[model samples]
Target: MNHSSLDSTMMLTSFGSFRPLNYFFFSLTLLVYLLSIFSNVFLMLIIYFESSLHKPMYIFLFNLALNGLIGSSTVWPAIMENLLSDTQKMSFLACLVQIYWGYFYLSSAYTTLSVMAYDRYVSICKPLQYHSIMTPGKVKTLLTAANIVPLFSIAILVYLTSRLVLCKYTIQNLFCDLVTILNLSCVKSLLVNLCGACMLASLVVFPCTIVLLSYALILTVSLKASKGAQKKALSTCSPHLITFINFGVAILFFAVYNRYSSFLPAEVYILITIDVFMIPPLLNPIIYGIQTQEIRKCFVKTVRKNEIFFRICELTVFRKSTSEHNS
Candidate 1:
């Protein structure tokens, strides 16, 4: 398809093979989407209301959950719709919007993880200076940088992508990623594309490097400290480390699949592509919720509160019914 032909609509070939199981996929997608939203939202709400969780670490956790909600919201709803509807298509403008938000979310996630790693490092490696360094002002600044930098980077990418004349309309992946969109461009502006790729790489690499350094320093400090200190540091850093490793692996798989998509079968390609987006959002909340003691306590408390409320309501209804029957 030419630029004019793609001006209005672009087809998503990602879900084409799953047409026969559309309803099945629809139900599954909807369930996962709702679960992800609920988990992330629940975590954010806990952090928001719990005064004890107002520390720099939890503040970053809140932002991480918020990013998960935004990122998952960008694509899952569209996927759910496509599963229900016969057409797996979106408008060119809509596609661009999806691409922008999807990448924005990815960038935000990496930046947030980097910030969290730094927080852990300070807390574990420099316990005396932790509060002094991670003050409200500093935390606010970090949060601002984390959120704004991603938006700025993604906007440049969207601008570059929007200028490309389309050679095809069908995107092979489950969602509109920057790489897939570039592949569809008729005019392969190699220089511009190379520069764009470098910019994107910097976004990933800079933050990842910071995270690695922070963890390395933390590890070195832990080795010299007492056993209690080492255990404390491990407890605090384990969740962040798990999340980082999980996200890194997912992105690596996605990058490899995109580069070697021609070698993979349709089923394998689809699974790999979807894993990039699907796994992190769902897994992050679960990993954090279970692993972080404060979050786990808050979650249990909230659940208990709801259960008590329901029991009280049931008792009220039962008493009311008995009184009315006696009357």
Candidate 2:
């Protein structure tokens, strides 16, 4: 696995010498990555262990957690290595793979979110047929679509990207991402840009609108009911909404900043970090861990259980390092 280091991380712009505070940001980001790994793993395990959470919403949560785990794992390690290294020179192939996975989970998250919207739609709009419409077969079909639909998009974007000659591999952003990379190409990346714009629309715009519209209808239906009924309905879905916000806000921020910014100095760099790369992993687990009670309980229980197991292991250790030290 070719890992990219940070020494090659330079933009084509004039901000050639202003080294953004690397130690602080690097340490902070590493801590965030560790937290993401810890929390997301716990969440996935909890969803697996707790049968009650195997329903529509929590299942979506599980899928989201898993998607985040893989996506962040692919990108952030390389990012951290670059930040700390003297020279962050990522190989061509590694860069391509990174871009691929970035697009993959992004699209997957969109598809899953849209499916969740439809789940809500059926559950609310046609309450009588909710079970029938979102049945095992139907859910499986939806799952298949989620998996397959984005691959076609990725194939097109990546193909266009491969044709472009990379004149400057010095990426402006912290990580070698699609936006930063496309900016470095010699040819007009307008087609690739269009591809990105279209994918963003399909993945983010469409699903978010559906989620909003479905919830609007749901709210309308529930508002016509007793106070108790409305509260209960809202309570059931609040976690999913938070998840949507976590992913959606970052997506929105990136969509706005990337299109508008003319690759300005620190302005563009900071925006890319916050919106595209840094925030989503940090937010995913927190939103899920806080909002989903079952996940929270299971996570606490698992932590306690693991602590006990670690204590036992520490007592039984072969003490290989200590043995070497003593010798």
The candidate that achieves the highest TM-score relative to the unseen native structure:
1
- lDDT of the structure predicted as candidate 1: 0.84
Residue-by-residue lDDT tens digits, candidate 2, 1-327: 113322233432322343567667678878988888887887787888878777776776777778878767876787666666656666666666777888887788878877777787677667798776777777778777776778788878876776667667666555546776677767777888898889878866777788888888888888788888777667657767776777777676666666665645556666655555556666777876886677778778878999999988886675866787899
Q: How far is candidate 2 from the true structure (C-alpha RMSD, Å)?
A: 6.0
Q: What is the lDDT of every predicted structure here?
A: 0.84, 0.71
Clashing pairs in 2: 5-88, 6-88, 7-87, 7-88
Backbone clashes for every candidate come to 0, 4
Task: For residues 1-327, write the lDDT of model 1, one tens digit per residue.
Answer: 235634668888767645667888878888888898888888888999989889999999899989988888998898888777766888888888998888888789899999999999999888899889999999999999999988887787777777778878887667777777778777777765775777667678889999999999999999999999998888899999999998888777877877788888778766764566677888898998888888889888989999999999999999999999999
TM-score of each model, paired residue for residue: 0.94, 0.80
Report the error of model 1 at residue 311, Å.
2.4
| Residue 148 Cα positional deviation in candidate 2, in Å, after optimal superposition | 2.3
